[model samples]
Target: MLKLGVLASGRGSNLQSIIDAVEAGELSVEIEVVISDNEDAQALERAAKHQIEAQYVGPEDYNNNQDFEQAIIDDLERNDVELVILAGFMKLMSPYFIEHYQGRIMNIHPSLLPAFKGLHAQQQALDYGVKVSGCTVHFVDQGMDTGPIILQAAVPVKEDDTEESLANRILEEEHRIYPAAIKLYAEGKLEIEDGRVRIAK
Candidate 1:
């Protein structure tokens, strides 16, 4: 079974979805541990509820971003995690971390990706006047949301939608697709070539 290590910095609804999927036997992976930059992150609470190890390693603890990422590497190594998932970790990981994990790191973004990456994706879509918005689960790289996408789910951007409302819609799709993407990765069905992801035939 694949061992999953999660990095999150906030509410961790997406993390919860992964945990639920694993517990329900939908995902053939075990959540080894959860690490958060925010000491008060609810992701810790979720991990505690599931009896999984939860760690809080704030920026102050590290001398630099590289050190911070090294700490994560150490933690993942200790847990023997085969895959690292970034659910909502706000901090940009060091390029070294991306290099170390390579294809093992994955993340979910609230946009089509190669689109409104970095942040405020819903607002960006609204401002850009796009009628359709969505969420993407992609491999993590040094560039923000620029890695090969594993899966995506489209959501309609309504005319009267506020950022919060639009985010809510995208989040629902995120919960569905993120787990599906991870499952694909676990099943060895994802193929990346020329920056595009193809399901193995």
Candidate 2:
């Protein structure tokens, strides 16, 4: 089974979805541990509720971004994590850490990525008057949400849609496709080529 280390910063609704999928036997993977930069992150609580190892490594404890990432890397290595999933981790990973994990790290972004590639992506879509918005699961690289795309699920943006409403809709798709993307990776069905991901049959 694939061993996973999840990084998150906030409510971790996506983490919950992954846990539910695992418990339901919908995916063949082990959530080895969850590490958060926020000590009070609900993601840690969710992990504790599931009896998975939960850790809090705040950046304040470290001297710099690289040090903070190194702490996380140590924890992940200790747990023998094969894959790293960023549900909502607010930190930008350092190039050193990205090189350490390389293609093993994945993140779910709330926009049809290569568009609205940074924070508040839902609001960006709303502000841009886009008719369609969605979520993307992609490999994590040095750039902000500019990694190779794995899977994306689109939702129509209503004329009356607020950022919150649009985000809520996109989050539903995030919960669905993030796990499906992990399953695809675990089954060795993903191949990265020419700045994109190719799903193998």
Candidate 3:
């Protein structure tokens, strides 16, 4: 089975979705551990509920960004983690971490991506007055959310939609596609080529 290490900083709803998929036999992988930077993050609770190993690696414990990421990297290595999924990890990864993992890390963004690339993406879509917004699953790279897309699911914006409402809708899609993207990786179907992702048939 593919071994995964998940990083999150919030409620971990998406992490729950991934756990649900594994239990349902939809994804053939194991979540070796869930690591969070925030000690009080509900993601830790979610991991406990699943009986998965959960860790809190606070930035305060480390001297710098590299050391902080190194702490996480060490934990992941100890767990034999094969894939790193960023469910809601708010901290930006250091270049050292990115280079070490390279294409092994993935993230799900709450925008179509290449569109609202950074934080508050749903609000960006709403502020731009767009009719459609969506979620994107992609490999994690050095840039903000500029990674090559793996899958996208769009949600139409309503006239009365608020950021919370739109984000709720996009989150549903995030739960769906993130597991599917990880399934693809576990099946050895994803290939990176020239800043893009190719799914082998």
Off by over 4 Å in 1: none
Clash list (residue pairs), candidate 1: none
Runs in model 2 with CA error above 4 Å?
none
Model 1: residue 159 alpha-carbon error in angstroms: 1.0
Q: How close to the true structure is residue 98 of candidate 2, measured as C-alpha lDDT?
A: 95
In Å, residue 54's CA in model 2 sits off its true spot by 0.4
lDDT of 3 by residue, 1-201 (tens): 999999999999999999999999999999999999999999999999999999999999989888899999999999999999999999989789989999999999999989998899999999999999999999989999988889999999999999999999999999999999999999999999999999998
Q: lDDT for every model? A: 0.93, 0.95, 0.95
Candidate 1, 2-87: lDDT as tens digits: 89999999999999999989889899999999999999999999999999999998889878888888988999999999999999
lDDT-superior candidate, 1 or 2: 2
**Cα TM-score of candidate 3:** 0.99
